[model samples]
Every structure is written in structure tokens, then in C-alpha cells.
Target: MTIQTVAKQLTRTTKYRLNNGHHIPVAGFGVYLLPPAETFDLVYEALLQGYRHIDSAVIYGNQKEAAQAIAQFVKDHENVSREDIWFTTKIWNVDHGYDETKKAVEKIALEVKESIEYVDLILVHSPLTNKEKRLGTWKALSEFNHNPNNGVLQVRSIGVSNYGKKHIEEILAIDGPVVVPAINQLELHPWLPRTELREYLTKKGIVIEAYSPLTQGRHLNDPELLELEHKYKIPKAEILLKWSYLQGFVVLAKTSKKERIKLNFEVLPEGQGTNDPLQEGSNLGKIDLDPNILDALDKPDSHLVFTWGGADPTEYED
Candidate 1:
């Protein structure tokens, strides 16, 4: 199936309702590889520039700074509160077992509790651990969901990252009532579409969150993307983001620049009459891509096109 077949009419205020009834912003600002020292400032810039979602992780080593920025953003904006923004973090791979997961979560909760009241979502960072450990991690997160008061940290929802169909099936096959994951974030981009897995995820009602949507600026120069860049009169990065959004996937874009952050969030309709991509507008629109163009970009085996940092954990089996 074509990626944009299930595309929703999106606006700057558009959010996808999860299975748990929680709403996640269509666009999120990712904080991967951001320096701890500069994370607060950059994250604050993103929030100020109209990014309502901030995606961070325990392994990123800057969750504290990201939390501080969110806290400060809330305090400074009179109309905005904690609930106005979405904050997502993850448990590291080492914290996969039941006991270790509980302790790790409690520790992260304690660390960020002073900055923010609760996290919007917490994900199992990867599926590289053994099946037992993976289920244990989910169990720990499930318990936290069922009983938020059990610890200092409170998470509104739980999910998995880099999980394939088999991995998700394990979670679903758990012995008793389990909180089905609300999200399954993956290293998705034009090069690595993962179409089959996406179809399975859609059937199961799990939202696909696209990370590294731009291929970390590595494939922006592709002939087709560049042609589209010229045709749409926008950067290839925005073109890729629109592609992900059109596919009904929550897209996370990371950049340290303020203008780029604004560009990534404030996508305008065709006749907005503003050549300046940084100009703010409420009506968000999609980049018009023909079906053939979308098909051309769907290279399933291109997962090896680039390595952001680590291997694709979705391929890992233990």
C-alpha cells in the first residue's frame, strides 16, 4: 500500500489520538546526541518556536536538561502548562529486567520529578535484550501504568522503540492483561520505509513514530528528494518530514538551529503567500507527491543506507 494512503489532513495543532486516548503531537523535536550543556537552551528554543513535543531518552544523557527546559517553558508561558506539551523518554537497554527496570524507572522518575511532574510517555528503548528481559521491562512499565503512585515518576503512557512484529507479538502474548503499546518508534525515512512492519503495526493499532526522518541530513542530496525540494521550493529535510507525516506516522525532527526548528514545525499550505519558511501559520499542509514518487522512495532494503549511531535494534534477536 502507498504510504500516504492513510494520511490525515494535518495542521500545526494536529495530534494523533493513541489507543489509550492520549494525544501525541504530529511533530516532535528530538534531542538525540544533543550536548547536555546545550540541551536546555536548544530544547527551550524548540518549545519557544512552537514545538509542543520534546523527545528525549535516558541514554541520551540529557533528559535532565530537557526536563528543565520543559519546566521553564511552562513557567514562562502564562497560557501553557505541563499538560500543554508532550514529553517522551525511554528506559535504556541495560534496564530491561523486571527488577532492574523498576529501579531504573524509579531512578529516572526521581531525577526528573523535581523538574516535571510526570513524563507523557516512557518507551522500552530497544528489543536487543532477551525475550525474558524484554517482557520483564514491559511488565515493569505496565505496573507503573496501572499504579503511577508506586514511585516518584508518573508516566501517562508506555510504548516500545525499535520493535518489529515478532517483538510486539511477544508483548501481546503476555500472560494477563497488558497495556498495549501506544507507540513504536523506529529509524524511518524515505530510504528505510519498513512497509511490511508498518502494515502490521497499523493492523494492531500501534502508532508508528518516525525518528531520523531526514536520514540525519545524509541523503538530502538524493536526486528525487532534491528535485522535490526544488519543486516544492523547500528544503529536502522538510520534504522528508512531510513524507513521514503523510504516511500517518508521528515524525521526530532534531536540529540545534532555531530557524530549522521552526521550519520543521510550521509547515504551510500551498497558497500561504509566504516564501519565508520561518513565518508562522496555523494551517499546516502536505507536500504534494505523486503516487509514483512515493513508490520510488519506498526502498525497503535501504535500511543499510545510513547508520545514525547504533544498529537498527528492530533486527536484533536475543
Candidate 2:
């Protein structure tokens, strides 16, 4: 991203203030490639550098490390309370439905060390909730929010991920989900901007969190990206990260390095904000995409991909 302001602007450090009263850091190190052994160290490094939010899910399988890092952070710093940490966990796709949803969330919360305190947020991991049991699953989450004991059900803000418009609408119509999902974690990057969905969500007051903000490191070689990297004197990756963030989206960036994590958090120069690589470039790629789990992550090479749902609102297109 390239931007211009006369006075010295604040560091590129940014956050997305969501509708549900939670502010998410626009940038933080990602952990998709991180093995369990390295997870804690990277997470500790992130928290020490002022990352308040950490996004993890059952599928990621690094929750234990992520949790340990947070607990250790609190022990290491009296000033850093658990309450100060905004931890996010998601229910997996296979866990969709009434009783399974209940058990899944319960297991995840407990896996993270059950606390009789407020949970930052919980998202329905995927949009593929069985049609017959979708409402019950959501209702189960709603109960989790209102439960007096706050056990496996300590979720505060409930939402969805990887859902498209039709799926979103279906969930929102369900009976009594008093809690509005505050976020829609989607696969967004300049090369594949979800323009239509972003516009819709902004109107609905749902914050969009961009996963794979760097496009899984696939766009770094593009000439347009290279040009911006040169123009801003930042790494092409930084240019991409800063662009997604500066454009007002909460970005979840993952890394397993102290230096790269620090480098990723560096402030971007001006003009990085207003420019859109996809907007003005005859790029190397096109936006025919699916919700792809990167090939290197032990998944099959070819799989149909789509968007994930978020905090449970409908009409989420793009």
C-alpha cells in the first residue's frame, strides 16, 4: 500500500473496531504453517509486540500452543490480564448441528482451559451446517452465550465463517439468535477482492476479517505487486498486508518467525492505502476462486473452494 500525508503519520499499526464492541488488530503473525513446537514461541512474540487478538480453531490444531502462549504472557506480565487478550476460536465443519455443535464448542472451550469469564468470540467454523439442524446448532450457540454456568458454552459474540450469501440469509432467519455475529472471516486479498460482499457487510455493520491476506504468498511475483513493493520501499508482502488493513478490514496474518513477524508489523509508507493493485493492474491472475486450504498443508491438490460464513447474518455475497 502507498499513501501520502505531510506530517509523520502513525505507524501502520491498525485495528478494526467491530460493531460488537471488540477491536481486532489489523495485523498479526499467522500460524497456518506453524507446527505445534513453534506455535507458542510465535504467539508469545506476537503478544509481546502488542497483538491483542489471536484467531485459532480446532482444525488449526495449534490451540494448545496458542493457549499456552497466552497464559504465559499473563504470568510474564502482571499488566497483561487474560481479559486483555481477545482470543477467538471456531467450531469445525464436522461439528455442525444441535448436539454436535454443543459438544464441539464445549470441547474447544475446555481444551483452552475453561474459565468462568467472558469469551471474546466464537464462530461457526464453516457454512456447511446440515440443513436439518442449522437452527438448533445456532440456538445451541445462543444458549452458550446465555448459559448461567459458562462452561463449554462461554461464547460471547457468536458468528460464522466461509459462508456465501444464500447460506448467510438462511442462518439469520433462524429463531432467536439474540447475539449478532460481529465478524465474517473471509478469504480476501487485492487480487480477489470480495467487493460485493464487503459492501453488503459494511451496510449490515459486520466487520470483515481477511484471512490469507497475503493470498498464501501467491501474488508476490506479480509485476504490479513488485511495482508497489518498490514504490513503497516495503516488501511486496508488506505492501499487500498494509493494503488490506489500510482499506479498513481486520487482517489475520500468520507467521512463525520473530524477525518476519516484526518485519510484517512495520509501518507502511503513504499511498499504500489508496492504491489497489487489482483496481489498476492487468495482473497475472483472475478471481475464479474457492475457499482453498493451501496444498502444502496436507490437503488434496484439487478441491472446490468457496467463502465461509460470519457472525450469522445473511445475503453475504461476493
Supply every candidate's count of residue pairs whose N, Cα or C atoms clash at under 3 angstroms: 0, 31
lDDT of model 1, residue 32: 95
Runs of candidate 1 with Cα error greater than 4 angstroms are 1-8, 268-296, 308-310
Which tens-of-lDDT digit does each residue in 4-32 have in candidate 2? 21112223333445665655555545566
Query: How far off is model 1, as Cα RMSD?
Result: 5.2
Model 2 spans > 4 angstroms off: 1-15, 114-118, 268-318
lDDT of the candidates, in the order given: 0.80, 0.62
Error of 2 at 116 (Å): 9.5
Per-residue lDDT value at 240 in model 2: 66
Return the TM-score for candidate 2, rounded to 2 decimals: 0.77
Q: What does the lDDT come to for candidate 2?
A: 0.62
TM-score of each: 0.89, 0.77
